[model samples]
Target: MEHNLLQAFTTRKHTVLTSSKIDPTGATSTGSLKVKDNISTQGSQEKLGKSGEEEKNLKSNKKLEMRAKDTGSFNIKMNPLNKDSLDKPDENGREEKSTESSKKMQTKKSETGEGHDNSSFEAHQETQGAKGHHGNQTTTAKIQQTTAFISKQDNKRQANQTQIGRSGSNVMLDVRRRDCSKTKCQYVIWQCHHQCMGWGDRLRGIISVYAFAILTGREYRISHTFPCNLKEFFHGNKTLWDEKVITAEHATKRNIKLFGFLPTFGSWVLQSSNLSETFPEDIITFRTNNDIIPYLRFNKNFTKTIEKAFSMPIDDFHYVTLFRRLFHELFSPNKQFEEKFQKYYQLLKPSNDSTLVCAQIRLQFIKVSGMKNVFKFLQETIKRVGKSKLLVSTDAENVRSAAKTLFPEQLVDIEGPLGHVDKPGSGCRDMEKALTDFLMLSKCDILIHSPSGFGQQAAMLKYPYKDVYQINYAGVITNLTIPIFKLENLYEELGPLGGEQPPSLPSRYIKNPQKYFT
Candidate 1:
């Protein structure tokens, strides 16, 4: 569509340019003609409240830039609708096309005249349909600059322009003169490229990236296609989600790294090597829950090492405490999720000891590992911790049914695997149950879980007095006390009130340590 911005130019006003919009949260936003309630598409100066939903439909709008120069001549730069104006005839055609575009710009400038005559521009202003000018337009132009898109898409469908990956980069064209030449500004983007498979796994992936950003002092941006439907919850402009929605196209171009499984030591080694001074890459992405524990340790040595490496003051950074803070920043409970959690979390009364236990039996993976002992483990938990309400969260359908059968009245779940709305799991698992399960599990006084990041996360999020148990493949139930189960002590349980020790990786997957490396 065409805009009368140039026509409005002579009116002596800065028009509202919607060609680009910067997200307030520092995330990149698409320049689309989206209906934002009653907000006008025209460049109206009226500001609107942030309470309504808007449709994001991009427009091929033209941007007109008029810059007042010190020489008393105005430099005008207009972005044309034809993006292919800069396309090369071949891969080798790039230089030629660039030269041609430059020549055309020079030709336009020459046509405008080599002399810095403001009266000549004024004489031609009305000829170009710029009316209502009082006198000679007081402006000067020493240099002219224009940026055009060279699209690779077919010409019929209205191909989009190449996006500059800066946060809130939606402006179509930039205007400047020779003296106004600026430095190339670079923006840092950290994305979690893990497939939106499971909710807990997705959380682990993003939380890892967030930790990375925090360590490097960068803004972490969120996307739309993430596992959970968190739009309404974060729409209130709280936390780091206060900006605009990110499109799939823009996110694809900004993905810099993809992290898979890397054991704790391997991760540490990579960090020391790749990030000794600073992150060399422009963007960093990772797989779901890669080996990050080593980088996020709570020990004095680890703290000093990280601080020395990043040259930042983080002498007091604790692994669990930092995790807690990041979790709070990323995932505030939505009203819907919170309502469901509170309903079942407070269902059963606590015992005289006020001890409530929720066991997250990862039946699918453990059974896949050839451990066919879900029922036996539940029975053992009941036997050892009597009268404690059993809130089970498992993936297998059969496991949920069996728990209901075994504990009948005593067993309660957050409506079980199928009851969740998000449905974060795959194969024999229920995905939606992840949020409900995690929320309810966090409320329990004790957690008996399989040795996975999901349980590890919940356990770390639990309060100080709360306890956690890691049920290994061998059915050895080990309680995780204050400092948590280190990589060396995963097979062994710590004593009730031991001395203060620093944090380390749990022994569950870090056996060979390098075995889990990608």
Candidate 2:
């Protein structure tokens, strides 16, 4: 029986081992004439075993493999978590693996639930090995501590990032962000922080400086009193002031200084018979540079002159309104006006030639009470001077003739139409027109003027000569403290004119002169 069994097995093996022309393993035959008729159809255990061995060999040498792998194919998926895979050499063929890389593999293996029972002994061995390599327990501990510290720091950083992202939520809802309730800083901080730099800050400072400059109303670098005719006030020399910049401070200071001097003018006007108790101080004190008209192209009256003396901006309609209300306070009645006019004459008699001639003509309106004395003074003046050119300004022909008799050869009369205006207080109109022409035309070394606005205005003009003289009216001499006769006496003693005996005058008239009006 054993012989028979051995023979059968050998026959079966032989039959199964038949080789095909195309495939030596006899796996490719398909038709009835193939090995199927020669042996049992089912593949034998020996052939199956041989196929599995071939597949294993194929798995080891991928080049020879034709069939897809079964057991090894599944291992490909698990290879990433395999410790053997991690133990494999790196791209550079280095045998070493970092702890981080090893831990990563272990962690991956843990996720797969495949051999995660890591022993405390293994961990202790790793610690002992690390300590042995470092040769100091503290050093190994410090490395571990540093690693843990870094890990904690990383976690904290992540948490902080989360908090920071949410921090603005409250900020956005803050009431401070509302435009209606915004603080001054909040309104501009964004622009200031991002848009404004050094240049922008400098520009802001410059704008502020300019705004402040405008408020002060001062010349960029110079100063002067208020009611200042910036147009007439020279930048450096008190002329040509229009182009200059000014500030309110400049205007205020100037106004105060100017108004302080107004009382002097006001007091003079107060000393007249027809004058009321009304004082000019009330107006002059309030006047500012803006109210003053610096340049008068046409003739101006007393009211106009006073109006132009202030620096305040004034509209014509407003001026008329103010004038109507303050007329009595500003002007004197004719009788008192004439009296004050006489006082100005005595107070502001010229100290020199042109003024002397002007003053003599001015005395024509005075009473003859001082006439004999004046006549004697004139006779002596002629004898001492011998010969002099006489320019007489007068509306009266009789007065002109009398002056001619006194200086017959030297007399030159300016003849013009006088008092043509029928209106009250308009007598000065014709006189002003005539004087304007005379000033432009006459080349006389000396000049005389009638007791009128035109005469005073003409006298105030800047003339080129050795002497400037004028007869001032009382209403204009506000600061005078001394007697006019005493000043006249002293001036006569000084012999400023061509008089024989010493003329009399006061020190105040010489050193400090009041504004002159004829």
Q: Which candidate is the best by TM-score?
A: 1
Off by over 4 Å in 1: 1-197, 224-228, 232-238, 245-254, 261-288, 292-321, 349-354, 364-387, 416-431, 482-518
lDDT tens readout by residue for model 2, 1-518 = 32331122121123321212212222223210111110211111121011222234324434311111221111111122321111222334222333333222211122111221221001000000001111211100000001101001010112121110111111111011122223211010001111111111212222222221222221222222212211221222121112222222212111111110111122122222211121111111111111111111011223343334322222221211221122112112234323433343333222223222332333322222222222222333333343344555544443444555555554444444432222233333343333223332122223333223334333323222212222222101111121122112212221223232211112222221221111
Q: What's the number of clashes in each of the models?
A: 23, 49
Give the alpha carbon lDDT tens digit for every residue of 114-199 in model 1: 22211111111101101121222221111111122111211121112111111111211111112112422122333322233345
Q: Which ten residues in a row have the lowest lDDT in candidate 2?
A: 139-148
How well does candidate 2 match the true structure in TM-score terms?
Answer: 0.23
**Against the correct fold, how does model 1 do in TM-score?**
0.47
